[model samples]
Each structure stands twice: as structure tokens, then as C-alpha cells.
Target: MSTMTVRMNEQDAELVRKFAQFEGVTISDFARTAILEKIEDSYDLQELREAIAQDSGERFSIDEVLTELD
Candidate 1:
């Protein structure tokens, strides 16, 4: 239970209000969800970057994977 105040230009505030109403959510809920989604997106991008960095341009066949599972 906390309160956060955000300052924006009138045009931006109106846009957000309209969008939240269109989506049938309170502005607070819409903003919260948007913030959380952005955070998740950042984490996902970081993981993708790390995986790409670790990739050695190597490919494994299905048989090789199955044999290693034994």
C-alpha cells in the first residue's frame, strides 16, 4: 500500500487516461503492468544477449544429444 505520483505533460496524461479507459483498467493498474512488463523485457533481452555471447557457432545433431542423455 504505497502511493506514487508521476508528473507528465497534459497531453501525455490525457493519452494515458484514454488508453487505460479503453483497456478497462485504472490508470494505476495500467501503469503498474506496463512498468513490470518493461522490467521483464529488460531481463529477457539481457539473457538473450548472454546466450548469444556464449554461442560458439556450434551445432549439435539430435542423435548426439540423445546419446549424451544416456
Candidate 2:
């Protein structure tokens, strides 16, 4: 495990502490989860954008697919 430190204003720190307490998690755990989730969301968005850019704009429906299979 590695330890990292972050600097924040007292008001922001207090808000994080209170919110963590309210959520029944330690400040460290809250911060870790939030940061990791943000990273995951960013990665997912980038992948979506790339997929859209590469898309061929083909159209299909479930009924059409089933008919083709029959």
C-alpha cells in the first residue's frame, strides 16, 4: 500500500470529513473511492468517444436480425 497526501483549504477539508462521517467511511476511504470512480468515468467517456468516432453508422433491429437468421 502507498500513502499519498493532498492539500485543501480548511473549509473543504471539514466538508470532506463531515461527509465521510455521514457516509460511515473514513476520509481516506471516501477520497480513494471518489478519485478511483472519477478515473473510471473519464476512461469510459473516452472509450465511448473513440467508439463513436469509429462507428460506421450501420442500423439494425432485433426483428431484422431474427429474420436474417431464419
Candidate 2 deviant stretches above 4 angstroms? 65-70
Question: Can you tell me which runs of candidate 1 are displaced by over 4 Å?
Answer: 60-70
lDDT of 1 by residue, 1-70 (tens): 9899999999999999999999999999999999999999999999999999999999999999999999
RMSD of each: 2.4, 2.0
lDDT tens string, model 2, 1-70? 9999999999999999999999999999999999999999999999999999999999899999999999
Give residue 69's error in model 2 in angstroms. Answer: 8.2
Indicate which candidate wins on TM-score: 2
What is the TM-score of candidate 2?
Answer: 0.84
